[model samples]
Target: MSEQPVVPDVAAPAGRGPLLEVVGLAAYVRLGLFGIIGQHTWDAPDLASSQRMLAIGLRVGEQQGRLLAIGASHGVEPVELMRPFAGVLDSFEARTPESSWWEGLLKGVVGHGVASDLCRLLARGLPGDLAAQVVGAMEYTDDDERATSIVRAGVEADGRLGSRLALWGRRVVGESLSLSQALLTTRPSFGELARAAMPATVAPEGPSADVVAWVLGELTAEHTRRMDRMGLAA
Candidate 1:
């Protein structure tokens, strides 16, 4: 009889991914704005925005690298975990199309916030050191402040823009939820991670339906709070 080749379990307990791609995306966006600034001398605002964006990109990129390192240390390939949700980021970028400077800024807010929230949720179930690394990768201290300033400026400049952006923000929430569900469906590993992340209140014998509802409810509530923080109607 021929000996069988041993196959390692891909879904075994291990580390996870990060918000790296999002920051990389933001970097490209900033560079685009920088080019626009170069084209127009009246592009000081964009220049300033570009500089800030570059800083965020650099910092977040470092954290992202750290996350990958930590994930590798734990024998987990973060890319495998992230592959299923690739569409989510693309969908978000598509849904929140940037037609103006203010809109671009709003996209930055929504993108960063959503990625951070997802990373935080995933980090909940991970081992201490790994979880800390995952969480740390998403720490954007100035996101809320910067978002607030941009939203306020856009609103003050044109009240109608605020209303439009409010609607856009709501759409962002819905799309994010949709993407999340889609990801879970496509990725069994992610579903397992989410299950492991559940609180103690969810009994071992509890129905998975209940667990799903609880997680969705928590995510929805958090989404509403985030919207409110951005001065939009939840």
Candidate 2:
């Protein structure tokens, strides 16, 4: 991000494989995330908590629609594009399932934040206007604060719970990043996609291989900032 954005050749931009994959990944991660909102509401501790969780679920629903539109704009249906990785969420949860309802809340925040952060990182390589669309589509809502407040309050009430959640957050960050890295490396076209999306004006950031490294670093830094903001350790 230190260097200014580089816009690539718009010649074949219409159907490049990379942006589609990135968009698909964004949509895929988001698709997997939708179910957790329901989990949040269903397992919410009380009426007020359930109501708040439901509100958050509604906001997530809006983002899901936006992602659909983004995919449509790209002339690719994300649902079909993501079919190859259909079990991604199942694998993610299997590796980092929440032990309790409260832990699920924490995972929702940390996990989605990490996923979106990666998509936002890759989206930077898209052309100016398109990049803005992808970035804006991922923007946070007040519901984020509503959810985090619940987790923070719970932590304040119980120091032991806070300690366990901190560990959980650390575990989730690793898994989420691992998933992102896997996506970036899964196809060679991804590097081409990123390079294709990048503005041509900026010189190569480094080797194409460095792109994944750079993106992961950015993701981790952003995730840590989020952890700090939420007053959670680990």
The best candidate by TM-score is: 2
lDDT per model, in order? Answer: 0.54, 0.74
**lDDT of each residue in 47-159, candidate 2, tens digit only:** 98899888887787787678778778767675555554566556678998788987898898898888877777778777777778878887765777777888888888898
Worst 10 residues of 1 by lDDT: 20-29
* TM per candidate: 0.68, 0.83
Writing each residue's lDDT as its tens digit, candidate 1 over 114-228 gives: 5456546656656676566566655656745654565666577877887888877676667766666654445455555556678777763476556556556667787677667
lDDT of 1 at 72: 53
Quote the RMSD, in angstroms, for model 1: 8.2
Query: Scored by Cα lDDT, where does model 2 land?
Result: 0.74
Report how far residue 53 has shifted in candidate 2, in Å.
1.4
Model 2: runs farther than 4 Å from truth? 1-16, 192-205
Show pairs that collide, candidate 1.
none
Measure candidate 2: CA RMSD: 8.5
